[model samples]
Target: MSLSLVLLFLNFFTPQFNEAGQAKLEKMVKDRDALTAQWKASESQKSGIFGNRTKKDMIETNEWLERIIKKDNLIMDELRMIGDIETITATQTGDDYKAIAFKQEKDVQALKRAVAERDKQLKEKLSERRTFEWISLILFLISLGLGFVVYKKVIKP
Candidate 1:
């Protein structure tokens, strides 16, 4: 029946609705029943010269109103807690992402520095090799000129 389906929905979803515990849900149901009984009793009274309600009835109604207000405040507190949890989770995730980005940037900088040092060493070695080659070429030319001078002066005489 539709009534059974409604009961099922309340049973399954009421706790999740406010994220309240089972004890809190039971307390809410008791408060709801008490308020309903008070409402029905007040409605059945005949309107008279006294305007329908005694002072005691007014006091009882005031108490029920206060109880309802307390329940609403509790629900609000639970909602605020859920919001705080979500905010914390978002902040933590953002921090983790920033850390990963920072680590990757550091790694890239380190690799760039290593490559620059390697290039500098290679350039130094290449310059040293070129100097050696120039010195060897000059020494060979000087030895050939000395050999020609010795042959003309000593061997021809």
Candidate 2:
């Protein structure tokens, strides 16, 4: 289970996940280039019509502009769709990361609680040991005092 989690974590950093993204980006660039070229061609055509200054020339120029605008709108729509897909993928990846981070945080908290419990037990044992030592010392001193009293009263008197 942990191994799978590690692999899932590593998968995000790999190029395979980005391959689809790279392709989408390339498509967008190509479409942009094509749109630019079309725009330039339309501009050149409109410029050529300037010298004539006739009603027919104006109509033709307007028509060309209209067609260019329509094509531009279509290209913009495509770009927008690509952007939406990228946004969704990013959101999903972010969610995955958040889940993994939350799990790791929970694990850390559990380990900290275990360590605190162990430390508390150790402290209790240390306190008990100190109490036992104090009691033993008091008993030993009492026995020595009693032996000295016996020597003075029985042997000396």
Candidate 3:
């Protein structure tokens, strides 16, 4: 029964891991598409600015540059969100695809933060499990010793 319970828990965790990973991957892809679109729009505006350079053209180019900056900021923000989601998801599943997704989500700096957070959380969980195992072992040994003493005093020959 204990084995079955542990297996069931493992099975339960598997889907959550996969689901989290898939959702993050999809979001990353969406951000990539958004970045591409923003890049194309910025390029078009840049071409327009270069085509005609006058006072009016300077004002238009300034507006175009502002739009480009806004688009760049949007891409940066989406990349950040995608990084966070991928990091959280990767910690759940040791899938290499998660690393790919992280790369697709953002640049190396973002990936570093994601990896660090994932590793930190994993270390904390492992530490907790180790502590729990030690505590359980101590309790089990004390209980066994107490039972042995009771048996010798009350029921032994």
Candidate 4:
């Protein structure tokens, strides 16, 4: 009975004794490795916001809007030469549109600059975090190595 019990325990725990579990464990390990690789690749491609954003995330300014307004105003002014009624209506709407568009353009340009600045700050923060992680890993490994050395010298008889 004791021998049988020992055999059962070995059969349950040993990988070779449990081929199905062993295969499953190997597949799980492989899947875990694949997932880790994918995560790393994705992280490397990220703007550091959990890889959820794109270059559009960087555009938070209205300078571009101002540019568009200036361009549209030129075209609108040119359109005025084609008709006197159009010239008057264009003048009436032009100031209001230009003013509003200018403000909006400035706001958009400012927003874009702000988002770019935010991304730069985030990049610095991530760089610091990576440095800390490396330092900690190195320290952990050194401590482990020291502990092994101390154990071998003082405890192993």
Candidate 5:
């Protein structure tokens, strides 16, 4: 019965582990890596600015800063996405637990109901047995009394 219940529970509420989001995470990682490489290349180009810092060099540096800021934003977005996924997974797990708990509660209630019915039946049977015993005792006493009266009346006279 327990095994059947477990199987029924599993069959009813199978968890869906989402692997599709993994591909998106991998793509985000690649994008971050590519951005890091671009930032590093931009840093290496700073050697030209150090020799004769011109407006062009400053503008180039500004562009590099912008790229870095863009990368940071992308990283932040990725982190948010990961956070969202974690929250979703946690919520799903919590919901599953609640469902299991509810099912268990239902099972307990059903068992309680069955036990109450059985107890009621047992009490009824006991009452019936007691009634029959009393009837039997009364009949026996009446028969004994009648035999005694017959013996007294017949044998004495």
Candidate 6:
């Protein structure tokens, strides 16, 4: 039953894990697209006297690159965690299978012992019944012989 529950949990959790990873990836893609659009818009702007706009764009670009790197690292870490979870689950499931197999073997042995005991009891009962039947037959034959002898002596005299 614990094994079944574990299987059920895995069935539910794996899809959720996949969905979370996919959502993160989608968010990253959206961020990248937004950054690209901003870069393009800034490129189309004219150079002012101070050129302050160009400097601001460079700073924003640098920040975007850093954010992208952080997100990638986060995603890689999540992937590694998922891999570790899979390894643990596999090991646990294998242990559960072995336990179930061992339990079944024990149950089988117990059933065989029960069947052997029942057969022995049945044979003993049959032997007792046969003995009773033989005794009854011998008693009946003795009585019949005695009756015949008494009838012949009294009737003939």
Please tell me which predicted candidate would have the highest TM-score against the true structure. Answer: 5
If both were scored by lDDT, which would come out higher, candidate 3 or candidate 5?
A: 5
Prediction-by-prediction clash tally = 0, 0, 0, 13, 0, 0
lDDT of 2 at 89: 60
Clashes of 3: 0
Poorest stretch of ten by lDDT in candidate 1: 14-23
Candidate 1 ranges beyond 4 A from true positions: 1-51, 143-157
Q: Which pairs, if any, clash in model 5?
A: none
Tens-place lDDT digits, model 5, residues 79-157: 6876786677577667777887899999999999999999999999999999999999999999999999999999999
User: Which pairs clash in the backbone of model 1?
Assistant: none
* Ranking, lDDT, top scorer first: 6, 5, 2, 1, 3, 4
Per-model CA lDDT versus the true structure: 0.71, 0.72, 0.68, 0.62, 0.73, 0.77
Answer with 1 or 5, whichever has the higher TM-score: 5
The total number of steric clashes, by the backbone 3 Å criterion, in model 5 comes to: 0
lDDT of prediction 3: 0.68
Q: Which segments of model 2 are wrong by more than 4 Å?
A: 1-74
Instruction: Please give each candidate's TM-score.
Output: 0.60, 0.57, 0.33, 0.43, 0.71, 0.57
Error of 3 at 70 (Å): 48
**Tens digit per residue, CA lDDT, model 1, 56-150:** 76666677677667766775665576566556556755666687689889999999999999999999999999999999999988998899999
Candidate with better lDDT, 1 vs 3: 1
Candidate closer to the true structure by lDDT (higher is better), 3 or 4: 3
Candidate 5 — what's its lDDT? 0.73
Over all chains combined, what TM-score does candidate 3 have? Answer: 0.33
**Per-residue lDDT for 46-103 in model 2, tens only?**
3345454566556765776676576667667766765776676677678777887999
Off by over 4 Å in 5: 1-50
Candidate 3 lDDT, 85-146, residue by residue in tens: 55754564555446556766788788889999999999999999999999999999999999
